[model samples]
Target: MWRNTMNDITLPRASNHLKADALDIGLTEFIEEFGDQLLESLNRSNPPVYAGIDNPARQWVLEGLKRQPFPAQAQVVQAIAALLLDQNEQAGIINAEMGTGKTMMAIALAAVMHGAGYRRTMVIAPPHLVYKWRREILETIPDARVWVLNGPDTLVKLLKLRDQLGDTYDGRQEFFILGRVRMRMGFHWRLAFWQRRAGGGRSLAACPDCGRLLQDQEGNLITAEEFQREERRRRCDHCNAALWTLMRPGKSDGGSRRNTVLKSMCRIPTIGPVRAERLLSDFGEDFLASMLLDNVSEFINLMDAKGNFIFSDRQAKRMERAMANIEFGFGEGGYQPTEFIKRYLPDGCFDLLVVDEGHEYKNSGSAQGQAMGVLAAKARKTVLLTGTLMGGYADDLFYLLFRILTRRMIEDGYQPNARGSMAPAAISFMRDHGVLKDIYTERDGSSHKTAKGKKLSVRTVKAPGFGPKGIHRFVLPFTVFLKLKDIGGNVLPGGVH
Candidate 1:
């Protein structure tokens, strides 16, 4: 009986003198009855168990809750942490409603994961929330060394990490907070010339020989260009000093994003030397630099150290418009500050990635979405936190799941093509799950019989929920969803509305 159970087959009731043929028939019937279950058990053993309330990592979640008391939130933190630690399950999602303390929960998970020997965790957030994530990590885990990889100073920060890649930090926990916009950017070197402008304050050009003012024939004030244009060994009319020689010398500064943004901000109305210096001092170089590319409205109501308004409303408006026009060109070795970390930072540098507001990456083809996908692929484990995981479409989850659970996607035969791209797989996924239909429209009211110039349009009218196969393949095994109502007032302070 034991042997039969081990082989997942049954033996018929024993007879005193059983025939060999009868015994063979009984074993065949038993094999047919249990073959599917045996195969299912074997397959289950291959994949790691999904993290649930009963997972061993639940202890870490309980400990974290003790420090920051959120019994209701602890349920989610434990489940996600378990999945992240599981060898087979490297990615999962925490789909909860808004105002449910997703940030706090993510911090708790980071704390637990750090305690469990994972030293590095990176949080990729919206540009506006980069600092907010850093602040939350610090507030939650006071000893955590938080790195903000979001601003003009990000390249410098990445260089520091690259320098220390070979060294060990004795198990010190490090957290890097990055914005989504910078994931695809890279850095390069270029030569930049700093030409001296002849305008504003320093309009007078000094003679090299005697330091006398050099003026043109008009006698108002000699421009630097006019002074340097003289073919002869020019001399000052007043002192006969070498005027042209002094005006032609050039200078340059390394073209860094920090310097470029500072110079650009200084050019805006009411943001002169004094205000620019104050702005840099108040917000730091990175915050000011990021404002040029994202969330410029953050500079609307500027104030001095003494709490006085620096720029009037009209001046602030002008500054906003000016900032919008400031372009960071790649040819000039200019880049968005976040690009340096995304491009040069080593792979697997972050053991865990927490994506806050994961739904924003639903547009799989967008730059930000692609960047998020790249970062997810680099990390060892990923936890996606989102209020709305799906946008009423099966295709919405396609790219997101492909990024988070990359190994699973590949195992399911959704791999990139021969050119090392996933475009074909993405298209196949859309065709399989998305509701696509064709629309025929006549050209300029032409009749149906006159279809020579008719256009056929392929439109995706309804992107409903995923089919059963998709759910079993992409969601059920890895995802853990919790609603506010499920926790109820027993866990929450007051029942969520």
Candidate 2:
């Protein structure tokens, strides 16, 4: 006989004298024993940390907690700090209610970590909260150097820090705050122009004196003019119509702005003034604009009027370098600003990652969510601050945990697939802790030819709370839960609710 304690069931071994009834019972018991275990183990894992308050790291956290003004805040900070300071723990969730000063607690934790020798930290927040996080960090840690990785000048700031990529920490504590949108963006070159193409293959230029078109002997438009006899203007040879002098945009006279911008582009080797002009004329403004935003590779091996390659290998390299020099802007590159920093910047650029409103990245398939996942993997440690860690289902936390606590996810045998979807694991998690409903149509007793067929079938799914196994795996060891109401009256001011 075999017994399964987990399911409280027993199964009889195969024997020649076994009765049919006994065999049937054994088969049913075996199915019942193994089925529940399979579902329960999907979202289950050993405690992330075996250490208690007696552990050295916990003691250090307790010591740091004494510095907090409120006892409730101190208690919450101690729990979070313990999880973060523990070597075995990679990530932790602070599910504190709104108005609980979660931001201040996070800052205090950063101070403790900084004092413990972790000098570098990165905070990824919503666009509106970028400055707020910076302010909080400065208010909490006076000596800390905080960098805002958002806004138009982000790329410029990153370029300045290129030399300091490998040296993220230089004794002084540093914090880099970035917005979530920019986390996955990149940089590329773009061109700014004002003239629109004229119709019928003609230039917009006209003779200033007679107000007539300037054409050569072949009837082709004469877009460029040569001055004669010390006079700065050229007269059309056909009708002696004085041609308008082309002046650079924002300038009084002489060169055209289009030509000037082209000239700057030609500084790239092998891309001379002639080829540069041809590029703008051939591709037109719309094509050039699109290429700048999405298809930069189109620049290499560009075709001419005869359909031949325009750029050489050496020239392409130079063009790429020149393109990299320019900063990316809105509608300029088909990537976010943060993506550029993540991809082009060196590895280990940040030592600590702080994600504010972290629950916003619950959808693993979204661009923002995927970007956050990449960023979380790049950092040495991560802290997720959110009011609603799990909206209503166990599946809600799966992707969040997968991104921030990748090692723990891997240890639990759940890995994201090529499409970045952990559907199998999510489904198993939903089955274990999520409420399920089954619905099907049932035939009415009377089969009526004229009456409406059958009643509509409706199924409702409700996931109320995490089961014991789920609480142990996702909540107890990795998360610090707190509510504003739990904080005693001593923490709130006299007028506060």
Candidate 3:
């Protein structure tokens, strides 16, 4: 009986297998039974997590709706939060339609990262969006130390960062939000000219490279290893860079330090040279020091609501102009200058980037599109949020698609032509890349005809949004084309979600 049983038995399982798997086995079966459990166990723990606030789309939405309640839309916030945690990503574009709460979404995302202990978040927004960002941040994430980087003292703040040598809040993850205009051109001006005067009446060290502190420490600075290290390690009397150990000062003199007071005073509106001196003189040296230690809520209440200190119209107007100069092009009616801001933050700083309205960047040569590309270069993983993924033209997808998956887009062959941003060459490049999937052509020997059969070689077929010969195609893999009526079918009268 034993010999017979042995003959009927299958071979013993592999050494790696469990005793229960004596029957016939396959890879799929193995995975189903035990492999999945093993893998799940591996991911069950909260591995030292870092929540990167790249979900600007969600964050923006949250910011926009701060006065209102949180959107009941779970998918929107979830998609954005995931983007924030995804370090493999570069940039994100939240394409929710206007009034769908894009600003609030961005604020939510920023709050999440801040709650997760990530400080120093920089938001680059449109001019119209600046006050919105400030208010939303204040309203939603109350504890987040935020400062809209502005004013004549803005440059001084930048230089003072170097002096503090990382001892200051700005050195860490302080929420540093700027209007897009301020970011692009305003930033360049700030670095080029403003940085010199950033040190609260002091000057920052000249760039170790081209002497253009404006150039950013990209090409020339990267080559000099020691200087870069020292730059990071040493804090100067001005700027946000690190300073040399030799320069750190003792404590007693810290209170009277002109740079320290300047650092604290810059964030205060209307507190420039003259006003700053008066405040210091009247309140004594400990004026700002006392304010700094106050509770955030009280501190905010004291800023504008208190009648004694409102920013002067002159000061506010000057700041408005400066910020406008950055947002709009140099002239009056210019569009938001995104590219200029790219110089300040560059791409590498944020692990993921969220573009709020990705459709706005579908054009290959538009200043906004180019700016998005620059951001893409800096980010590791990118997610674009857009309801209108395609422009009426095929070329619109060229820039947007390239930014998402560069390897696949490049392998498929999409290269930009230099005639200008919206040129036919740009359209052609979209065709070369797999970005344009399908095409429908109308053939006409002598003339064209309709389905009436007068004579027709022309027809329409389902194809990709952008095709080789200036054709149209699908916007998304599975477009969730939404409308009010369709939504009303499932939603209650006051359904928040």
Candidate 4:
């Protein structure tokens, strides 16, 4: 036991030993003396060249913005604007550190782009910051119009937008603040089908009001999967009988229909079970359904039965401004906003799309990423706002870049697969400009007779950080990177830590 323990704890001799004579030499001197080619491989200094922001875009931002930006912040706005304006780039990134006033800078960017003929800007922000964006936009741009597309009335506003398209350019810049959650949110839906007697204790999914099998155009019977669609027509086609129901899913269908609705509607603000029952008794289910399913703007415009102008004034600026947290579940078929915009709104309806916390869209499987990508395609140009643009892995930025720089991505042979993400292209990118490791494991000195005795395996994994080629190709040309160090000394009382 002692011999075995000593053998186990023994140390092996070095294959090559360091010589005492070389101890006095510094690392650089030693490498130069023994391996001189290492000195030749060191890269030369490459500094970032700043773009001049003396153009009209800068003037527009300066003349219009209420709170003037610091010279460095102005530079960030100017640099990003140049990519969209002078260079005509479809997308640009502002990879600035936190506490850099990205909100104020973004408003200024909108002003600059508005001056350059990009009048409509859509900002996809976090839910908590939706109102913040609205407040900043309203305060910064003198006569600008801001819409918060993050509430329960989002669909109503979208419908209103659908109605107001193609109006003559009123020269007023409008900013639409869509919450990331709202952007990817899908509405509650069930395929409208009727119940018909099939005799042997079986009921097929048929039109609720009309007896028709839900089938595809090819005559194939529609599966339950077909009901899970992005955009749905809730009414029946044969007789226009309403096929779909409009209500949030309940815990269980355990009570009478009136009680179910009363219980559900009671959860919303401004109404309790008693008020809900009164509403049900007064308006009936069908009218309420129509209001809940569509025409939410009309509901908010409702007059008090005793004659008040909550009606004259859901348009009331005072009441409206005071109601910030008021939420409702009004929307059209609860379609995902991105899919709705893609199908209904015209291309280029929004002139610019500003993605806040842009790093959130880096995942290949992110629903918001796909939604943002769809919006990017719809908008004329895009500007991504992020603190950490690259999360070490090369593929992290693949889907994001594919969304923003689509034309260039396609030009470079990065196209989407059947599911619409450039996954294969991302793999190819990882191989080309990112690090990947192929690992092999084998059991050498063991002989086994069981079926589970297999011992060799190969696996591949991505390593951290993008390569130089990737930086030069995708990041260097498109990103406006600003650290706190750039503006900290001038803006903050203490220097950047």
Best by TM-score: 4
- Per-residue alpha-carbon lDDT of model 4 for 224-292, expressed as tens digits? 445446266666556778767665654435545555556545655555677677778777765665554
Steric clash pairs (candidate 4) = 187-334, 192-243, 193-206, 193-207, 193-208, 194-206, 194-207, 194-208, 313-316, 392-465
In order, candidate lDDTs are 0.68, 0.65, 0.47, 0.74
Model 3 weakest 10-residue run by lDDT: 327-336
In model 1, which range of ten residues has the least summed lDDT?
Answer: 243-252
Q: Rank the candidates by lDDT, best first.
A: 4, 1, 2, 3
- Clash totals, every prediction: 0, 8, 71, 10
Q: Native-vs-model 2 lDDT?
A: 0.65
- Order of the predicted models by TM-score, top scorer first: 4, 1, 2, 3
The candidate, 1 or 3, that scores higher on TM-score is 1
Which stretches of model 3 miss by more than 4 angstroms? 1-72, 83-89, 113-120, 150-173, 186-347, 380-389, 403-408, 416-425, 432-497
Expressed as tens digits, the lDDT of each residue in 93-169 for candidate 1 is 88888767788888888877877777788898866677667767777777779887755456667788889988967
- TM per candidate: 0.60, 0.55, 0.43, 0.68
> Distance from true position, residue 312, model 4, in Å?
31
Report the poorest 10 consecutive residues by lDDT, candidate 4: 1-10
Q: Can you write out model 3's per-residue Cα lDDT over 1-497, one digit (the tens) per residue? A: 12234224345655664556556545465667798777667456423122233345545545544354333433445454564454333334455553455656556655555445444455555554555667776876665666554333334444443355435354233555544434333221112122343444544444433344433346332223233334233332335443222222223234545555554555455557676676566555454454432222222333432466344556656544443333211111222334333444444454444454557666655665666666666654455656676655555666676766555455654544464333444545644433543444554355436433233344422234444332212232212232234323444566533
